[model samples]
Target: MRKPCWFLAPPVSRAARWRGRCCTGGWRVRALVRDPFSAGAAALAARGAELVVGTFEDRAAMRSAMAGVDGVFSVQPSSPGGTVTDEQEVRYGITIADLAVECG
Candidate 1:
């Protein structure tokens, strides 16, 4: 099977709030965000999507968490990954691209 399409990478705080129990699925239906830990999986549990979350930036941890996952959704940190490379401008573009592909 092909790699699973990663959908969203909403912050842990946001995903924890609107997980499951939707209100006509307005913003809730925009796309799923996969955060570290069980946040993403918990959020998607009620939506019929098997999303898995964990501290995958840790290689071993990421591998373990993504063992069965088909794809990943991620964004580099604004400072280290973004500021270091001074590519903060590309952050939004990357996010949009990821969203588009995941939504498709």
Candidate 2:
């Protein structure tokens, strides 16, 4: 039987941990990354993750990333640094959850 495919979103370190565990368990790991060429993404690729280049705000990309995956592991960015607003974080979380249900 084929093992399941998992779609993962970052903070890279956490996703990398999950990726490691999943890869070790013989499951396919797919990662959603804003920049595929970034060092973190490259590290993930080297560790056997399939990188899906996109941001959480991009619904089309999110859908594409989620396609055919058996599970999704996502972490919405917190707004402590003002990089992402509270509302935006909520929206992103809702969008990802909605897309996961829709994709499934």
Against the true structure, whose lDDT is highest?
A: 2
Error of 2 at 45 (Å): 0.5
Looking at candidate 1, what is the lDDT of residue 1? 32
- Give the top-scoring candidate (TM-score): 2
Query: Against the true structure, candidate 2 has what lDDT?
Result: 0.77
What TM-score fits each model? 0.32, 0.86
Clashing pairs for model 2 are none
Specify the poorest-scoring 10-residue window by lDDT in model 2: 1-10
lDDT of 2 by residue, 5-102 (tens): 64645654455566677766777777788888888788778878788888887899889878888887777877676788888889998998899999
Tens-place lDDT digits, model 1, residues 1-104: 34333334445544334334331233223233345245555546555554444331333333343344444444443455443354543654464454444444
Candidate 1 Cα outliers beyond 4 Å, as residue runs: 1-3, 12-41, 65-71, 77-104
